[model samples]
Target: MVRAAARLPLFFLAASLVAGFLLRAPRSQRVDSEAARQSPRARTAVAATGELVKSLRIGGTIGTLRSAAIRAPELRGSHVVGWAVLTLVRLADAGSSVEAGDVVAEFELKRLEDHIADLQSYVTQAQASLRKRRSEIRILQGAWQHEALRARAESAKAVLGLPTAEVLSAIEAEILRMAAAVARARGKRQAEVERLRALVIAADLGYFDVWIRKELLHIERHSRDYKRLRMKTPIGGMVIRETIFNRSGEYAQVKAGDRINSGALFMRIADTSQMVVRAMVNQVDARTIRVGNRAVVQLDAYPGLRFSGHVAEMAALASPRRGTRSAGRMFIRQIPVRILIEDKDKRVLPGLSASVDVIVSMGQRGVLIPREALQHETGQQAGTFVRVAEGGEYRKRHIAVQGLSDTEALIRSGLAPGEQVLLKGLPRDQRR
Candidate 1:
């Protein structure tokens, strides 16, 4: 039994040693297999000969080709009461069509009425004064005529050598002078009457001479205001905006009694018949943007839809935003580029945000490779690697990269088409 027990201990120790060896051997084999699978193999550098060179892209937005703003008219009188919008018969809605000489709006005539009344009063006073003047002139004329007639009779007697012939001659001369005076008085009276009549007639017709002159002067002063406030579409197009006062028994924020300031923004209008994409480029990129440069516009609201356009113009000057500084002292230059679209729909609205892509250049056919292939060494050398068939190794090859994009680079030279290049990390054994 003692010998069997000692033998059993040795056998058990041998079995444990074998099992440990078997477990360790499989683990070592597994490690080797995994390493082999992870290692990179030799790959033939193939050339990608396809359309690689494409147009350079720039950004822009969709906008209206034409736009307008409506403003208030310049009216006089601080105490001038509220305004009454009198739409002329021919006036149309913002998007509606209109003909020339259409009345857009008219002011209330209360002030004008008061002016007419005051003028009438002045006319009445003028007529009364004129009548008094005429009566005085007539009385003077009558007295002068009587004296002259008596003197004329005396003169006739004198001429015939009657009694007091010298006195009579003097009296007859006085009568002739008195007759001339009466004629002058009559002429003055007639002029006064005519002037009064003119004043009265003008007042009766609601047309005061001075007031008419003033009205003309007012028209001259507000001509520009009228033109602006009329809010006519400079070109024939669809009205994209309109301001309609609601008359649903709700009092307006500004009413007939409320005062409005001159130059207020009363309304706005835009022409939507044609649309454009307006893009603002940075000062650095603004120089590259020119009229007639082709572009692509994308709306965030409408994804996957791209509209094509061209740069119509660039602004002459740069205008910065208020109270804000630009980055890198690079003021936001004014690059007013208009991108025209052939199709205009309701989807395009004024002030809708949009993105624009301007084509700077196009590379139709060129050699391109993934950007990851490029590697920069400590010596500041940029190059890529190509795998060699021999012993699964890679050769460090230098290539000239012309243009680089987000995902690829344009290979100018030092590489041929259908050439195989290494991707990802190098083989673990080869990595230093």
Candidate 2:
């Protein structure tokens, strides 16, 4: 009887444990059900009828639409034959703001200036030498004139003596006649010598004239080169130094004391006031883009920032897309499109990666919601759907999508304005 009583108490304890477990199971499930109902499975949005704008998104770089490339000025004028390796003496500070006519770069003008000064001195010396030669020739001509006049006088005197020979002896007359003939001969020889000397002097003067003129032309040419050596910006903006092959055969930014070839891409002055995104569109989608279409530009650097823009221009011809291509897809081409950003912001700079959404179509009235709100069915039911909110619960509703955009979708049927839809995707049982 004692064993039975102990066994009975043990059985009662076991029974009590079983009964509590069964009773607590239902209460735990009810609590879980209440919590699930309290928390929302997906975000909800009310559908509204409004203008739907469809946009085509494209990736590109942000750059100044009116920016000008500052290239190394071509060396021109006399004595500069072939390509001249220009030595940079001074360069404008990189990223410095500048205006039109501001001096951006200067070559090693010391050498050119010294050369010009030397030429000037040479020109001065040549002028002096030419004047000295001219004066010497004049003096020689005067001496020749004096000598000719003396010869003529001597000849005249000899002739007068011959006329007096009539009252003198025959030997004296013969002597006077011979003396006059010799004097006449000497005069004739002197005249010929003076004429030849004058011709030679004129030739010497001509040589000096030619040499001086040539030197003057050379000086003019070098002077012009001097001016060109000082590079100036044609348009005002920020100066951006370009990469160059330095003396060490490595590419580096152009700086003072670097030697650059003429006509090389030296630098650029980008107009930050007006920026544009040079984006590319696949050739197939290029037909839908048109000029004057409104666009929204967003820079990758600043995720929250957006700039209003418009389609400024489109390239008529397509070119091979830049960057790497996948295998067997080497023939893909893209059309270049330039979008002009109307909003001014300091952060808009060149070479920034940007996303441009060009609004190709707009002003269509329809019931619109985010494209994420629409769900696609599979297998047996193949159509678009949305989880519509009805009173306190949600139900799946069929919807007809008329058009789709980068962010929103236009609903044509099976959905109406003032209806709420779920944006997040939920399980079938949970959605109900």
lDDT of 1 by residue, 1-432 (tens): 999988998999999999999989989999999988886663334558655433434445556776655444554442443333332223344445433334433344444456545655665665566566667656765775675566555555444453333366788766665655555565566557557755664565343345555655554544433444444444444433333343554434323322334555443445676788766666677776667877667778888677767777677877663355758544645545567766656787667777776666666467767666776555566455444224456667777777765446688887777666775667666666
Candidate 1 — which residues are off by over 4 angstroms? 1-61, 76-260, 321-323, 326-334, 366-432
Alpha-carbon local distance difference test for all models: 0.58, 0.86
Candidate 2 regions off by >4 Å? 1-48, 76-83, 150-193, 320-334, 387-397, 413-432
In lDDT terms, how accurate is model 1? 0.58
lDDT of 2 at 405: 87
- How displaced is residue 286 in candidate 2, in Å? 3.2
**Which stretch of 10 consecutive residues in model 2 shows the poorest summed lDDT?**
75-84
lDDT score, candidate 2, position 167: 90
